[model samples]
Each structure stands twice: as structure tokens, then as C-alpha cells.
Target: MGDAATPLADTRRWLERAVIGLNLCPFAKSVHVKGQVHYALSEAQDAQEVLEDFTRELEALVALPAPERDTTLLVIPRGMEDFLGFNDLVARAERIVRKRRLEGVIQVASFHPRFVFAGEAEDDVTNYSNRAPYPTLHLLREESMDRAVAAFPDAAAIYEVNMETLRRLGLEGWTALDVGPHA
Candidate 1:
């Protein structure tokens, strides 16, 4: 197994440079600042293994108080590297959450080095917002998420704003961030 430090470093950089620096997720900065995000590495090389890791993480998250750990970014640095395969794992992870009877309490957001939006070109700059150096599953507490969304003004417009933010950055600028697939 690899040192947890390496993955944590990479994940932290991605959160700062891509997610925070790019303003991809507005709520991210606050949670990050409060040290509420848990960065965990999953040494899984297959879909089932990844699912197992997801189950473990979910249980841990729900077992603790929300203030202790508001969210978790389960970093899968190996396996399911392909966007489609990573997406499939995400589906299975969601089902596992539901089967575990933790559906509304927690939810998942997906990130991949090759994440692509439907109908968007493979090289589209906007998709870079969701791209990370590895396949990552963002485990969120639904209650906290709902509260954050409610408190944030004009939450519904976040998507449109993010799209425009990427366009302004352009592919060249995104490449400069050095946290994309190739990085």
C-alpha cells in the first residue's frame, strides 16, 4: 500500500487549484477552511473492491457527528480510470448506499480524470471543472448539503455560473492549472 500522504497531497491540490481556485464549488471553500473534509485513499483495483471501500466510508461518515467530518472525498487512484467504468462504479456505490439504508442521509458526487458531459466534445473546457487527477467519489452529508444550499443565495444559478467561469478560463488556462488528467 502507498502512503496516505501522497494521495492527500494530490487531493488537496486538486481541491485548492481546480475546485476552489476555479470556483467550481462555492461551498467547498468554507468546508475546506473549517477542516471539515475528510480525505481518504481507497487502494482498490476493481469495481467490487471500490464498492467495498465506499461502503466502509459511508458507514464511518454516518457513525460520527457531522461537525467531526462534514464530507469525505474517497480517492481511488487506481482502477476504473476510464470515465465510463468509473461512472458505472458510481452507480453501484449509490445502490450500496441505498441498500445500506443510508439513502437520504448521504449522497455521492463523482469526479474523474476523463469526466465528460453528455453531448460535449472530449476536449471541451467546461468538462475540466469535473475532472481530477484520479477517479474520486465525493461523499456528502445530505442534511448538511441541504442546509448549505438553502443558506446560499441563488443556489440554482451555480451551474450556469460554473460553465461561464470555465469558458472564461479557456482550455489553455485550465491546462495551466496542472491538475487535469495528464497531470
Candidate 2:
């Protein structure tokens, strides 16, 4: 998080070792291999700046077809480190999506260094699935998502499957991947 490239490097590693390697995101590998994933590290120091930058990225995604740019990783290297604040920022981000009339066309997914599920304990291993090297706003295309889900067998079970995978990996195994916390 300190260096300029740290976020991207850590993020790429997380994708490689955790997301893709563990098969957490079945669709990620294909886009990644095709060089369609856009990773943009934002240098914004506050939420406002991050929001502006996020809007720009969202627009950028809209400009390109799904094949050229499937999704975007707007990684904020600063601000919103606290999960509560980060969650609030995510809400604002969604508002922007709706404001831009991209509600059904684009959606925002969240990833944070300290992501936690509503009912899960802070140390729950399941949260690691949403943890990223930095606070990232994942801008996804609705149509692409629908296509991916339609093709994925039992798409509704992804969450349950991911939870089970993390449960088996445990805290030690997650730490071994060097992606995030053990607690």
C-alpha cells in the first residue's frame, strides 16, 4: 500500500493465487488471460476524489465492448481503509451508477482489505474471499455478468461454495497465500 506499484502487485497476486488459483471467480481467469481486465490504481486521498475517478472508470468501461474490456479494478490506495467508511463509499458508488442511468447496464462489486459479512465474525475465514489488496470498486457489466451466470452451473451456489472453500483453506492456508489477514 505504501509504494505506487504495491497495490497493483498485491492485487495481481491475490487474483493469481487466490481468485484465479483457488477458482473463486470462475470467469476471472478467462478475462485475465485475454488481457481484458483493467486494473487502475487511484491515487485519491479522499472519498470525493475516489468517486470522481470511479465515475471516469465506469464511463471508460461503458465506452468499450465487453470483449475489449470486461471489467475494471479501481483500487484506491488511500482513504476508505476502514471497512465502515469503505462500505459507505460503496453505497455512494452505486448511487453514481444509478445517476448515470447505468443501473441495469453496470453494477458495482466491493472488495476491501478488511471485508466482513453482516453476520460473520470479524475473524471468519469466509470474509477473505472479498478481501483485496486495497479498497477496490469492481465495475462489472450487467450483460456480461448475466451471460457468465447463465453459463455457470448453480450460479446461486457460488457464495456457499466460496464459503466452503475458505472453510477448508482455514486461516493458516489463507495466510500462506499472503493475500490477507488470518484474523
Q: Which candidate is the best by lDDT?
A: 2
Off by over 4 Å in 2: 180-183
- lDDT against the true structure, per candidate, is 0.87, 0.90
Per-model TM-score versus the true fold: 0.94, 0.95
* Candidate 2 TM-score, C-alpha based: 0.95
Q: Write the per-residue lDDT of candidate 2 for residues 1-183, one digit (tens) a residue.
A: 356877887788888999999889988898899998999988998999999999999999999998999999998877878999999899999999999999999989999988999998999999998998789999999998899899999988888899999999999999899874222
- RMSD to true structure for each model, in Å: 1.8, 2.2
lDDT against true structure, model 1: 0.87
Q: After aligning candidate 1 to the native by TM-score, how far in Å is the CA of 20 from where it should be? A: 1.3
